[model samples]
Target: MPHVEKAVKDWQQQFAGLKTSAANLMQIAFPPLEIMQSPTGCCETRLHWQDQDSEASGYVCIDDFVQATLQFENVPHSVAGQALDEVFGLGWFNGAELGVRQAGEGVYYWTDETNAAEWEVSVLPGGLANLSIEYTNAPDIATLLDALHTAYEDPHEDDAAT
Candidate 1:
């Protein structure tokens, strides 16, 4: 079996409680997982999401989008294949107006006229998956982090008795 446990633990800190856009993306991308924070303030999760891609037909797609990056953990190879199908199916037959291309065995690229993103998947020995997402020409992730910090500030701090 692969070193799925330790591998996920390594990244789990960074994957723990997210804020702003990061939290939003986490909610959308991994609806089944719980976003928690470690004592050290890093993100963590234990749920493994199976890959899912379907020819979704709706007006809910993005428009003039600048950028987006989505990451996941413990995904299976079979799920990866399913995601590949979803991306290609939308690109080729659904008039989704996006570009999809395979970069290598476990790498895929999705892009449009003004935005670009990549999905890289690495499978551990036990068939566990580690996925990394990167995006260009989109909102900075730091912005999301900042939003989280800002939300935690006390509203009455400035008004405290002098």
Candidate 2:
């Protein structure tokens, strides 16, 4: 797909501007099975996870728009396997320690020791050619510190009881 290639090239250009090298940009081949059917068309893309100067930071580039949904046509078991393989191949999550959970209908969560991120991929309920991704940034160091203080504080005053 030309669009898919263009998307990958665009990402590479952006990365180059940041003085970063995207060592790996693999193409996810279409699945052999049909799990969900998309009347229009379906395409797959790849993402990379890199360490930013020893900090735990990463970016996920969806071939389509950041707010696009993921759909399959007559999605089969093989497709699901391929999809999981593609996601994990990016090394977005650590091999063993990372947690991947499905929080809701089309929503998934990825969390490691230092960071957490959520992804929602699904087809538009009806037959619409659109997708979406809603991402919420994990709490920063300051936010976590404030939460720790609140956790240790007592909710009641002992003087009143005395």
Candidate 3:
């Protein structure tokens, strides 16, 4: 797994431009979202969902500079992960072992690596399984984001009735 962590640095390096760019990119990539800032200075988006049951969230942090984190949650760990394995052409993680890959930026995956077909899964409370991915920069990010946007924007039967 590839890892890079920067320790505390001078205040002068605090750059807002990069952080702003990351925030802007997120808006362009995601559907209608609710964003919030933490008292600790981290920027976070409330869990966004396509259907009422499934939920997801994303985050961006800036201290000395900008660091964007991309994550999606509540994906059906089995089917969804298999689909991604086929769509992205990579082995899936099952939320047990760690998997890492690189593209525009380094990405680390946490899931059960044992389940080849199950893919990256995080077993939530009550045995609900989910898939999550975190990355700073990646080539497939745009395509994946667009797909997610489409899913989120699609009109649902419940929404249409309302």
Which candidate achieves the best TM-score against the true structure? 3
- Report the number of the highest-lDDT candidate: 3
Q: List the candidates' TM-scores in order.
A: 0.35, 0.22, 0.45
Task: Indicate whether candidate 1 or candidate 3 has the larger TM-score.
Answer: 3
lDDT digits (tens) for residues 18-80 of candidate 3: 555555565576545334545534443222334455554443332232333444555433333
Number of backbone-clashing residue pairs for each candidate, in the order shown: 6, 20, 10
Off by over 4 Å in 3: 1-14, 38-65, 76-87, 90-120, 123-129, 138-143, 153-162
Q: Model 2, which residues run further than 4 Å from truth?
A: 1-20, 27-77, 82-108, 119-162
Regarding TM-score, does 2 or 3 come out ahead? 3
* lDDT, candidate 3, at 33: 38
Shift of residue 34 alpha carbon in model 1, Å: 2.7
Which whole-number lDDT from 0 to 100 does residue 48 have in model 2? 24
lDDT of each: 0.35, 0.27, 0.39
Q: What is the lDDT of residue 138 in candidate 2?
A: 17
Expressed as tens digits, the lDDT of each residue in 2-80 for candidate 1 is 6988888866554443233444553444343343434322222212233334321110111123233435455443343
Expressed as tens digits, the lDDT of each residue in 103-138 for candidate 2 is 112333334333233332232222111112223221
